[model samples]
Target: MIDRRDALAGIVAMFGATLFAPIARAASVQVAVIDTGPPSSAVFTAGQRALVSALSERVIPTTDTPGAIAAEVPQFIEKLLADWARPEDKEPILAGLGAIETRSRRDYKVAAADATPEQQDALLTLAMNDQLPGGADFFDKFRQLVITGYYTSEIGITQEREYLPVPGKYDGAYPYARVTKVFSS
Candidate 1:
């Protein structure tokens, strides 16, 4: 007794729900998707934001130069996630954040952000050392992405890491110590 239009609508609704369920569950996913070619309707959830914030904090904590939070690393990560990564890859990224949070909560009796610098370092080291629960490959990918994102930022490239764009046309015969000034990208 179902009309063709009704059946089509039901199918569409189901498809939409399935596609957006993870995004809806985590708002950060939408934020990640933002500016990365996804529609504006896709939005990040509280948990997602927390995850992004935590990851950013760990990657580049508040220091004399600047931290990941200040450089908007969360937004950067979100965009990369939505634009560069495949749909199947997103869950692992989110789960990586969740794993860090869960581990922090269990080990330090606090959220990842709430943990001390030493604790944060320990967690990051552990994550870097061991295969994450979600998967070893996913963890490695996430770490690589985070490091790449952090180091590529303006503050990161110029201040934190050595970045040279021109190097004054590259003197092939110049002495190593003579090149004192670094270049910017």
Candidate 2:
């Protein structure tokens, strides 16, 4: 018997990461409870957790709206990894994290979590574009996990995207200009 969640995870894993965006958006409102605990415990060590937190924040930084940290994306990721990921799925992430720390220390003379935001952003940019030799694979998975975790989070649904529980009648001719954010049901 195959679990639907596993199927979904496998689907996401198989496709290009960009393909998951609509799925993430569609699944957003269905998210029930977000774990509100210390993000460091099972999947990541304290230092690793800090790195995850820092990296996630850089991935979805705090602008006027709250960022990934506020959405508890790191904790969500920790839970996902501990509960959902297999050993094969886990190894790249672990290796990727190590690479990030290695780069940070070598380039900035500090751990990734302790590096300045600009420095961290630079590292993330490298990973994002596949410039970091060992980091691209990790960043791809990490970014997808972060996004999936975030959109399903309360902050992402309620704040980053708009949510209206009992929405008014739709206007067929509503101007795109009037739209502020993506609406979540």
Q: Candidate 2 clashing pairs? A: none
lDDT of 1 at 8: 67
Give the poorly placed runs of model 1, Cα more than 4 Å off: 1-44, 62-64, 135-138, 161-168, 180-185
- Lowest-sum lDDT 10-residue window in model 2: 15-24
Candidates' TM-scores? 0.61, 0.74
Cα lDDT, all candidates: 0.67, 0.84
RMSD of every candidate to native, in Å, equals 13.9, 9.4
lDDT of 1: 0.67
Top candidate by lDDT: 2
- lDDT score at residue 139, model 2, on the 0-100 scale: 89
What is the TM-score (0 to 1) of candidate 1?
0.61
Regions of candidate 2 where Cα sits further than 4 Å from its true position: 1-41, 168-172
Residues 81-138 of candidate 2: C-alpha lDDT, one tens digit per residue: 8765554677788888888898899999999999999999899888878777667898
